[model samples]
Target: MDDDTILVTGATGGLGREVLARARRTGRPVRALTRRAALPDDPGVAWFTGDLTTGASLDAAFAGAGTVIHCASDTRHPKHDIPGFHHLLAAAERGGTRHIVNISIVGVDRIPYGYYRVKLEGERLLAASGTGWTNLRATQFPELLDKAFTVLSRLPVMLVPAGALCQPVDRGEVADRLVELALEAPAGRVPDLAGPVVQRLDRMAAGWLRAAGKRRPVLAVPLPGKLGAGLRAGALTSPARAVGRRTWEQYLAGKASR
Candidate 1:
């Protein structure tokens, strides 16, 4: 393990950046896969330029890398998630990759959201990748909640799914767990990671409004069909498996201070 280089995809994204930073502190050789041709001046960081969509130029990225932390996803083009991930799997196999750590969202199996469907397919692909792998399902992040509220705030009144429960974990905490998985022997599927507290969607929205200094009133509307029912039933949260330490209110306070 000491000689193997840890390669991370989606190096520019929020979670991936946290993974890269934590990996660097461990003093293990780290390589960040990106689309840009130019890399930074940091001697410790090795940058690989490649396109996962076509799998072209990935040879250089997979070369000499024994462990891979896959944090990249194609949300805009859901169709691309599986094909691109297949490209990664093929390259990893050819490169003699020992372990692959994948990040996934909780409730992908039950949620009917388009992007979640793609994530579910990804899980299938990894299970049969024929390589050592570990997949982790983490609850929603504070950033995602913040973004959702920001978009809904466009309306005069923010409409939330009534009785919907949420467990929002910090991105940095999830990153730490991914790195821990990458360091250990491959685990097929780990336990779910969740936030410290399970709160109602309306409560989270109120906290966000207070932090952002907005007075927009939040209205809870009963969501329809299975998706709404699952959320209202607390399908996204694991009260017994609250592995993360940071709470949503703490996250809001942290953002406000910054």
Candidate 2:
């Protein structure tokens, strides 16, 4: 366990927390950045208070960090994405950081969604930054799918958009891969990591209902757009390279046990 510290942005979020926890298991010092000082105190971990919006704040957070795991993203509110990511990359370059590990979604370039477009732009910036970097593109998290279902299940019958393919991964597994990337030398763009099985969006919604002890009938409604067509045509799932360990059922079981 050397004093060489790895900096993790978005430390309070689900994937970020898992990355920090796994990084700490190696006994290496971790500097985790958050928007506020709400993280639990840990001796092995130092907290840096900063947001991605401000380049100065990000520069302060990157100080003394050898490697950076950039898990911070603004998918919910994409308006801040371009500027935030630009500032983050600039700050990392200024701080003389060696390795940068970035987490991205699979099919970001293929999908016509606004968030994915922003993510693709961010990836482009990192790729051309002249720094040692590895970008990990992964599928959606099972937790995220479950949360989406929970929100949609409020209706009398859940209406799933037809022609959407999904291969949701476990956040823990994605976290492990991101930490591994942070520790090792840069490998450029890595292969996409997906779940064990490719499922349709309607089926995934049904699975969620079953896992949560609910019985909401799922109806598939055809969508009329390129984004819907891409999703339905299995653009989001990778069949030959499904490399995840935890299945959706296993994730649900773990949640039930907890």
Candidate 3:
């Protein structure tokens, strides 16, 4: 219940784990919230069991934590995101949490995808919640693309969206910015963070195939609607704000080395 504790939601996930590790380096009391009833002990973090979807055990999670870095999202069931976010906002308000830094995807407003729509609504809710908040919109993460490619590579040929452009930022880089924002006063809707390069999806897929030692041919398939058009238009990229230092090639190289 330290007043200076920084609570991280989704602490076991990719980005959240990075944020939690970096936040611990600052020597402040760090709390990690997870849905799991039991977690392996981590001496630096005070673990809290909570569920945003049901608003279960949230009061104890938010109890005296001055800042919250919200990185939780259920991509499979995107419909639950809004309700979960609403629960978070309510808990923050009730607990008098001083600042909240929310992680969101880029092009959420322009993209027609259901998950992106939910993310956009979450941003709006945080802004109107009467609590101090900051929202960061980042482009696609390399891990997400890697998972997609793993699924698509199972077919005879990889089917990539025709002319689809993607900017795959490293999750760790995004985590760095989120933790930096969490320590500062809330700055609403800060500048977008993007990958170092914007490359065609097919090219990225080819790179993945090479790295993973898969010899599948890549075929660019035309997407027939607004969803396809949005990706082709590069709505998911922020060329001007391409401040992320790590490249997809670097991420793949590191993964291969590991």
**Candidates ranked, most accurate by TM-score first:** 3, 1, 2
Off by over 4 Å in 1: 1-3
Each candidate's TM vs. the true structure?
0.96, 0.94, 0.98
- Per-residue lDDT for 1-258 in model 3, tens only? 566889999898888899999999988899899888888499888999999988889998898889999988888888888889999988987877999999998999988988888999999999999899999999999999999999999999999999999998988899999989988999999999999999999999999999998999999999989989999999999999999999999999987887
Candidate 2 structure quality by residue, lDDT tens digits, 42-161: 788888888787654676678768798988876688868788888887877777788889999999988898899989998998899888899999999988888888999999899989
The CA lDDT at 177 in model 3 is 95
Error of 1 at 132 (Å): 0.3
lDDT of candidate 1 vs native?
0.89
- By TM-score, how accurate is candidate 2? 0.94
Highest-scoring model, TM-score: 3
lDDT of 1 by residue, 1-258 (tens): 333789999887789889999888877889998866776676778888887888888987787689999998766787877888999999888777889999998899987888988898889999998989999999999999999999988888989999999999999999999999999999999999999999999989988988988889999999999999999988889888898999898999988887
The all-Cα superposition gives candidate 2 an RMSD in Å to the true structure of 1.9
Candidate no. 3 TM-score: 0.98
Candidate with more favorable, higher TM-score: 1 or 3: 3
Give lDDT for model 2: 0.85
